[model samples]
Target: MPIPSRAALVEHLVRTRIAGDVATPRDNNLSHYRKLANGDRHYWLGLELGDRWTDEQDVLAVMAERCGVSDDPEHRAGQDTIDPELTVAALDRLAARLRKAAAGKERVLFATGHPGGLLDAHRRTADALRAAGCEIVAIPGGLIADEGMVFQVGGVAVLERGATLWHTHSPVPMAAILDGLARDGSPLPDLVVADHGWAGCAAQRGFDTVGYADSNDPALFIGEAEGTLQVTVPLDDHVFDPRFYEPMTDYLLDAAGLPV
Candidate 1:
């Protein structure tokens, strides 16, 4: 498929519900935001917060600025919003980073918690980067055991030819991967493209990272703000059909000077 022009892609972003008016309910976003403010580990997604974020209102302000969600504390319910412009702007930055990584032949890792929603895009990104001569690293063989949760084993970090990993959210998987790498004295990734806990944890580990986030997932935004994360594209993650992201993938690849 031919890549859409910027204007056309932006139009598709709103028309297909990839951006602009989002489907993430305000209440749901608020619920997560409140959890983040309260320092819930699940919502924090492995990010350590500073004292300034102790208040829910302060978190709201940050979300409002970064994710385009409503800042009104009075908003008790209804739909949430993500500015399409913000998504585009962030994608521009993401693409620039990808271009730099490709030029430098950086070893890259890509993972996603929202595998159902974003795997296609990430896969395409991986393919393009590989075609550009960048090495897509895979960190296989890890187990994640969250407290009070069932232990998940055989969660190997398989890197597809297109550069995507199986569904992953916990930093434990990456931590295990890094540990194995250190044990074998293998090189670590120069960049990580991921979302949710994967992105947060990698950033916390001081890896150059960029990823997507919904209005509710404030950890990546906070990480970006704190300089731990490189860039975060804010949008309604998991709200649209997977194919709706093709144009976006094309845009990013083209922006990176990779073949679309």
Candidate 2:
């Protein structure tokens, strides 16, 4: 079938809303909408902006930086990073739009993720939404970086030939390790590796499993879950942190059958 035109898209959205084909619209103006073929609805979506795209976009620059993807060859030599600035800016933009929706007494559900160490930012965003009278619910089932959050299994230490792997986590360093193994052709060592939570659990299934640890790594991934009014990240603590706000917004809008 031919892709729908802009006007056609709007018509589809209106029809879906009227037919109740879309999920219940929140009480926010300019609410992001999503419509699936199976007729399911979601409040948020994820975006994928590789290395170069992230650097070019101001909103994603900080997240990319936080992910350790920068121009500095040393940091970015092997892998790309998510810019923290970009992630926050994207959230700010979304929050602004959501605020407008809230003004009109509409329900707004924005979704995204932040670095593990940046819990404060997430809390601040939640506070802002509450101030606007928009309900906020974060998806659960992951480990936070520090204590008070669920501190699971321990750390891992791998020493091979001349390479020493210490305290690595999945979704973050795991990818890095895979990349390193691929690019550098490094061999795995026979040592004790400890991981906790989902990422570590997943890794343990494939590695020489060690037990739990303190401060495994500084990354986590939440799944494509909807809060009362937002969607959180979907990876483990730090599986794959891609700074993707624009893409996520575009996706949710598209999924809602709204015009970009």
Candidate 3:
């Protein structure tokens, strides 16, 4: 695959609703923001918060800065937006992190709550990192309970030489994975590349973590703000065709000096 030019990637981002005119509803963003501010654990994913985020307005401000959502609280029932430029900028940062990991042959793990949308990108990234001689650690898998549901198990999807896990929404899956690794006395991952609770939990546990987020998901942004998360690419995470992300994958791999 040919890496996309910056201009072309930006255009694709807008055309696919990854950024610019995003498909995430404003009300959904607002609801999540409110829940985050109010200290909902499910909304928090895994990060602990200080009093700095107790107010909804404060959360909204951070969301505006990090996720490119609207700053205005009154505009509540329209389309939520993510800046394409911010998305591209964060992707560059992610590439830089990948480059550093590749140089060191660091142990890394990749996972996603958004298996239906972002798995392809994670899979491609894992392949490239493995080719660069990095150790892609696959944590053990199990049936983990969901944080928000009373009787549901968020089953883990381990893939790519144990480099990637997918379809997990709760932090329990990650916690269980970490526990299993510790019990077996395996080295912890040097870096974790993931999204949603997987990213938040890893970052909170002091791993070098980077991931993608939609405007509606404020937990990763909060984690980034608190200095736990290393990078977050803001966009509509699951609204578009999965193939639309191939150019981005190519661009990021190229930027990391990996084979595209």
Best by lDDT: 3
Badly placed stretches (over 4 Å) of model 1 are 142-168
Put down candidate 2 lDDT per residue, 53-129, tens digits, no spaces: 22223322322232223333223223232333333333333434444544543322111122332222233433444
Question: What tens digits encode model 3's per-residue C-alpha lDDT throughout 113-155?
Answer: 7777887888889889999999888665443444321111122
Report RMSD for candidate 3: 4.5
Question: What are the lDDT scores of the predictions, listed in order?
Answer: 0.78, 0.27, 0.81
Q: In model 2, which regions exceed 4 Å deviation?
A: 1-92, 104-116, 137-260
TM-score each candidate. 0.89, 0.24, 0.90
lDDT (10s digit) by residue, model 1, range 21-109 = 78888899888878888878788776778565778888788888887888889997997788788888899999999999999999988
**If ranked by lDDT, best first, what sequence of candidates would result?**
3, 1, 2
Q: Specify the highest-TM-score model's number.
A: 3
Worst 10 residues of 1 by lDDT: 147-156
Predictions: Cα RMSD each: 4.3, 21.0, 4.5
> Runs in model 3 with CA error above 4 Å?
141-168
lDDT accuracy of residue 206 in candidate 2:
45
